[model samples]
Target: MSLVLLLFVLSKGFKGSRVRDVRVRGFGTGGVDTWQTTPSVGWSRIVPKFHAAIVKFDIAYPYGKKHEEYTKLSAAGRGSPELLVAEVGVKDYGDMENMDLAERFGVTKEDFPKVKFFVNGKDKPFDFDGEFNAEELKKFIRRHSEVYIGLEGCLETFDRIVDRFMTTENQSDKKGLLRKAEDEWDKLKSPSDQQIAETYVKIMRKVLEKGGEFISLEKTRVEGLMIGRITKEKKEEMQGRLNVLKSFTHDEL
Candidate 1:
């Protein structure tokens, strides 16, 4: 869909909702592209362009909450060359334009806000059954495809180390990955990145000293701190820690 039409639909759909104004101010300015006429363009033209494409099938007039959630996901995916975030706005009224396109994907008006991830070279797209949260959806994409969608507070480099650390049963190999993480930590210049890097390194050391169980124990500890009457800054710090901790435990979808 054209940007103008997408805005028109959102403006018409959201009407009195709290998100309407927020969405109108700045939403699709991020990487979210909208398509009202997918049939003409064809999946053949679209699917081949990226490693994976996350497409939302919803009515031209959609639920406000879903639209808001999708916009957030799109923002997260901005500048990611490996992924395409898009929405197809179907019209089920009047001539029911785009309804035929929706049916081609097994979607109906009742399930308006359906999401699917179409991986390049795949015959079938994967259905997203998780919550509408951007972080959860990013994890979903990461699990299904080789594409890396970095979560907030999670460093891409340390994430790779974590993956290597968890997969190997060899103590020596795990220790080597830990040392490598420390080396990478030393090279980082940003104080904020260093802080996040330190958490990854700390978690790695703790895991080595204790065991894999340290991850769950530490996550619980951080979650406890989050629930306390902490300042906003402290809460955000704790949340960042929590995000890094999640990278250690997120399993394949």
Candidate 2:
């Protein structure tokens, strides 16, 4: 997102126009259900209308001409705007349209190196308003787009788990919850239940040594499930794992 945000900032500061040419780079039905957005848009809408757009612009007057950095921004785009936009839902048009662009975004000539997002092309474009980087853009997009994007494979799975477990404050002294979590984890039979148990087990192994954050986190994981029964073997296995986990090294952690 930083590279993308940088490309946009440069594209606008250097280019003498707005990015309107870069159109829909992909079409898919996957994100809608996951994000709970509007129904799958047709290819026609995805190309230019529904897809995210980055409309950039250069500064005004002779000074704008003297220091415009569009070339540098274009260099970044030369690699492939399509690839960057793939998961980001962004398309760097590289200052395509020259429509009094700065004014349209409510900025003045001083804000030359500006970046605004026309997410889904419905609302008025919004300014990114911070560091021109990927991480920032990702957080911005996660907030604006309401989509959990940018992670892949194991990291992606971890992201989802964290979303479920992330807590800002410490938890109360909920005694004996670890045993309760273990009981629930044992009774779960569905694939998702098993997955949650697996994550709970992984995090639980460090329960005795980790910080309050981990404590709050594990409590959250346990709290997400309802109480349930446990088998004798499962309880024994849990105890055995706890015994081994007591000696976990930093590398093992």
Candidate 3:
């Protein structure tokens, strides 16, 4: 999709999608695009406040359906041994909240987060020893890459089957060889690694079911991902500098 169209889609969210009530000010003044996305009343109105109580959450709108595709792409697998590719498309870097934790705090492994949600707050127990929460991971999709969360999951069966056909154990086609290697990696991991692999497997299955490989799916993939990225520290710093609409107030909205 064209960059202009992508910006249009992202702007719609800034105006307010179901889970978020957002607004933009001072954007396009100095050749820079800036905006804020805040949760709507529903988030805070939920007795305990979903935003605060929950370590992570997302507001699902028609636009947010891109994430469903992310889950699918992440789990994708090629039936043939010739190809085993998993590519993640980051949304827009500027819009992602966890870039701080994902990058600065060292959570992302390559493109994926090592640990997604930290229960009991970052300061409470401060546990950084586990797998990522899928739902929470969605929040960090870079918001800039049309396909920020894309990944490929391969099964040991797939590689073993390919291995059987190769005249020499390591002599399969380059792509096919990589598939076997990935499968080997999967086998030697702890339960956490296995879970992550399986999550990708499930997502890939879903994508295949929906005919996700079709060009039509790219439209959804490319939406709302044209913004530029600012560092997590910079984002917080900017939020403080600019008086964007705040989600909380003493008076009722």
Q: Which segments of model 3 are wrong by more than 4 Å?
A: 1-141, 145-187, 213-253
**Model 2 regions lying over 4 Å from their true place:** 1-48, 58-99, 151-154, 167-253
lDDT of each: 0.75, 0.38, 0.30
The C-alpha RMSD of each candidate to the native structure, in angstroms, is 7.4, 15.9, 21.7
Q: Which residue segments of model 1 deviate by more than 4 Å?
A: 1-41, 61-63
Distance from true location, Cα of 31 in model 1, Å: 7.4
Strongest candidate by TM-score: 1
User: What are the TM-scores, per candidate, against the unseen true structure?
Assistant: 0.84, 0.36, 0.18
lDDT of 1 by residue, 1-253 (tens): 5433434443344344332111112135634433322343344445555678888888775668767877788787765666767776777677676677678889988887888889985758999988887888989999998888788888899999998898899999999999999999999999999999999999989989999999889889999999999999999899899888888885632
Better of 1 and 3 by lDDT: 1
Per residue, candidate 3 scores C-alpha lDDT tens digits across 103-135 of 433434353422222221232212222234332
- Predicted model with the maximum lDDT: 1
Candidate 2 TM-score versus the reference: 0.36
RMSD after Cα superposition, model 3 = 21.7
Question: Model 3, residue 213: displacement in angstroms?
Answer: 9.5
Per candidate, the number of residue pairs that clash is 3, 13, 18
